[model samples]
Every structure is written in C-alpha cells, then in structure tokens.
Target: MDLPEIQSIDDLALLVEKLKLGLVSAATSDEYEFSDEEYKRIRKILLSNPMFTELIPSYLKLCRNLSGVWQYIKHEFSTYAERRGFHY
Candidate 1:
C-alpha cells in the first residue's frame, strides 16, 4: 500500500502505526522488507517538517523495526506526555 501524505504530526503518527503493522506482517510472512524507496519517501516527508528534522538522522540509523522506532521515540520524547504534546 502507498503511504499517505503527512501533513501534520498526527499524520506522521498514523504512518508509523501503519509501518508497525506492515513490519509485523512482513516478519510473520518473511515476504517483505521495508523498501529503501519507502524509507526515502518517509525521510523526505519528515525532513520537510522542521519539528521532525531532529529525528530523521537517528531514526534512519536505528529504526529498523517498530520496537526500535518506538523505543527511540519513547526515549527521546517520553512514552506518552511528549507524544501527546506533539499532537496538539
């Protein structure tokens, strides 16, 4: 499935959730990998937003799976509070 346009932080969060589900499905079926093209698209979208710029580099390096991405987001922004702030 094609990714949706990320117009806000909420959009980004939704994309991440979709990616997580995709990753889980891929792992179970052993038939897919998150393509480099998809990563580039995601990177481009995030870099377009100043609020997400700080996350792109580390995220590119460390976010190979949902758990890694989740941990990084949680570690950098806390699990709940900072994420809630981003949405508002």
Candidate 2:
C-alpha cells in the first residue's frame, strides 16, 4: 500500500493506525512477538526506507531503539489516564 504523506497530525494518525494493524496482523501470523532475526530484518527495512524518515525527525526519532520509547509510551498513557481520573 502506498503510504500517505505525513504533513500534519491527522496524516500521522492515519499512518499510526496502519502501522498498528500491520503489527497486529504480523504478530497473529507468527503466533508470537518478533524473533531476534525478524527484528533485525525489520530494523534493516526501517533504516533503509526513506518513507520512515519523514514521520520521524533525526533528533526526536526512537525507532532505532524502542525499549525507551515503549517505556515513554507507558508513562505518557499513565499520565493521560491520571488526568482523566482513571486509576489502577
């Protein structure tokens, strides 16, 4: 599928939705999370693809490494939930 140009937040959100579905489909197909080899291949693809560069800036991008980003996402969602009066 052709990726849409990410010129704004709405475009970016669409890209995110697409990515979410793709990842979910891949995980279901594999019956598990990505293996090391699969992860390496994915990394190679992202690194080589020019399309990803537009969505992420050089300084703010975290896809090169994702553990920190995962943690950050968790924290961000936790903060958001707190603001909305949601709790554990």
Candidate 3:
C-alpha cells in the first residue's frame, strides 16, 4: 500500500497510529523489537518530515514525559490492538 503523505501533526498522529498497530501485530506474530537502527530510522522520519517538524516541541515534550518509562510505553504500543484513549 502507498503510504499517506504526512502534512500535519494530525497526519503524523494518524501515521503513528498505523505504525503502533503494526508494531503490536508484529510483536505478536513475529516477535518484533525495535533495534537501535530501527529506532534511529523512526526518529529520522519524524524529524525529517516537514509536518512532524512543525510539532517537534510537543513531540519532544511527550518524549520527555515518557523518558523513564520508555520500555513500558513500548510494551503498551507493541501489545495494544487499539488506542484506548488520548492520555498521550
């Protein structure tokens, strides 16, 4: 499938939702884990994307909030089939 063009934070969030879903599915089906390289790639995608760049500050803040609990955050993303709420 063709990837959607990201041109706004909403678009980025939507893309992230898809990615999170994929990660969850992969974790179950293929035991996927984020490698350092893969993590770098994700960060690169977000920072390089024009739309995501516009919301970098908010993104950074979110990251800061989750810094100590990154493993928990990853586990949540990797297993949850649906996003339950907007606590993030």
Candidate 4:
C-alpha cells in the first residue's frame, strides 16, 4: 500500500489518526511494547515513499521544538497507546 504524505503538521495529525494511536500508563505492573520488527515495518513503509522520507526532518522538529511546538504532536500522541505507537 502507498504511504500517506506527512508534509505538514496537519498531515501529521491525520497520519496519527490513521495509525490509531493511544496511550498507556507505566505505573501499572503490566506493560506493553511494540516490537522492533513492527516498528521497522512502519518506518520502511514510510521511507518507501519519497515524500515521507524527504519531510522526515520537518516532521521530527514537531517534537524537538522546545518552544512548545511539541504540544501539537503530543496531543496527537495522546490517542496512541503508551509505548505502543509512533514516538515522534
């Protein structure tokens, strides 16, 4: 399948939704994790598309942005499972 273009913050929001993100609490005795293989597969698919590969840096800054720019991405990530979905 073709990967969706995440060229902007809006696009990233949509991508987060499509991926069905959610959060989990680490305080509990039980913990969930996503395997390296699964992670690699998603990255592979994303990088498979030139658009996603080229825009990766911009996408990353959404988190690295210390000026509270990460809030947007953080909100999107709130819907993802703790340690389950994409990190950035």
Candidate 5:
C-alpha cells in the first residue's frame, strides 16, 4: 500500500483510517508489519511535526500490532500522565 503524504491533520486521519482497514483485513491472516522504510518515513514525519504526536496513542489502542512503533513514540515523547493512561 502506498503511504500518503500527510500535510495536514486530515491527511493523518485518512492514513489512520486506512491503517485500521488494513489491520482488519490482515487480522484474518498473519500480523501486519510495516516495512522498515515505511517505519522510517513515519518516524521522520512524526519527528518533524510534533503536533501530530497526540494521535500515536489512539493508533496504538486501535492496533497493538504496531507496538514497536508505539514504543518509539513513547520514548520520543515520554509524558508520565500519558504513559500511565496508556498502561491502564
């Protein structure tokens, strides 16, 4: 699948929706794993735009398959309250 360029929050929302659909489809088979390149691209985007960081937790809750990506985000933006909320 092609990763869309996320210039605005709407774009990110669409990407998240697409990912959720992909997860639903992949659930019938094996786990879904993002390619290394895709991972790097997403990481770069998040790093460059901290405004979109709030979406990480929502994505994690929707798809635990991407825990590694969540870990990276958690590490990069560790807030005690947010981490506690995620754990519980």
Candidate 6:
C-alpha cells in the first residue's frame, strides 16, 4: 500500500495513531505502566526516527533521550497546535 505524505502536522498526528502509541497524557495523578521490553521498544523506535527533529526538535530530543512512559509522549504531543486523532 502507498503511504500518505507527511505534509502537515495533522498527517503526523494520523501516523502516530496508527503506530498504536496513542495520544500522550500527563501523569499528574495516575501513571500508565508498561513492561520493560515494551519500554525498550519505545525508546528504540523513537530514537531512530529523524523526522521528529523537523517537528518539535527539543521535545523530540527529550523524547528520544529522557522519556520513559506513554504519558510523557501524550504530554509532549499536546504542544502540537492542532486537533489530534484520526480525522477521516
């Protein structure tokens, strides 16, 4: 299948959803938990993506080096100035 072009932030949001990472949420009260293996997978997948540098460079760097939980991603993505989730 052909992939859609990443021409806008909305496209990125759509792509992220399909990755199954979901929108991040802050751990202000409750934190989501993940297995050690899953955590490693997240880190590995994130660290390898260079496109993040073009979107939110600092935030992407933090996600690559410092993030540990799903909530952190949600919180970080919250900075995106558009409505999230699959729109179609």
> Best candidate per TM-score, number?
1
- Colliding residue pairs in candidate 6: 24-74
Quote the positional error of residue 44 for candidate 4 in Å.
0.2
Positional deviation of 61 in candidate 3, in angstroms?
6.8
- Which pairs of residues collide in model 2? none
Give the 10-residue window scoring lowest on summed lDDT in candidate 3.
79-88
Off by over 4 Å in 3: 1-18, 21-30, 55-88
Cα deviation in Å at residue 68, candidate 5? 5.2
lDDT of 1 by residue, 12-85 (tens): 78766655444433333334466545655565565566776676556645565455655555666643545444
The C-alpha lDDT values of all candidates are 0.55, 0.43, 0.46, 0.41, 0.49, 0.41
Candidate 6, residue 57: Cα displacement in angstroms equals 4.9
Q: Which of candidates 4 and 6 is the stronger one according to lDDT?
A: 4
Q: What TM-score does each of the candidates earn? A: 0.40, 0.36, 0.34, 0.33, 0.36, 0.30
- Angstrom error of the Cα, residue 36, model 2: value is 5.6
lDDT of 6 by residue, 1-88 (tens): 2333467767656555533332232222224443344434444444455666464334434543223434454554453332133111
Model 2 worst lDDT run, 10 consecutive residues:
79-88
The CA root-mean-square deviation of candidate 3, after full C-alpha superposition on the true structure, stands at 7.5
Per-prediction CA RMSD (Å): 8.5, 8.9, 7.5, 10.0, 9.1, 8.9
Q: Total clashing residue pairs per candidate?
A: 0, 0, 0, 9, 0, 1
lDDT comparison, 2 vs 4, better candidate:
2
How far is 33's C-alpha from truth in model 5 (Å)? Answer: 5.0
Displacement of residue 88 (Cα, Å) in model 1 is 23
Measured on C-alpha atoms, candidate 4 has an lDDT of 0.41
| Candidate with better TM-score, 2 vs 6 | 2
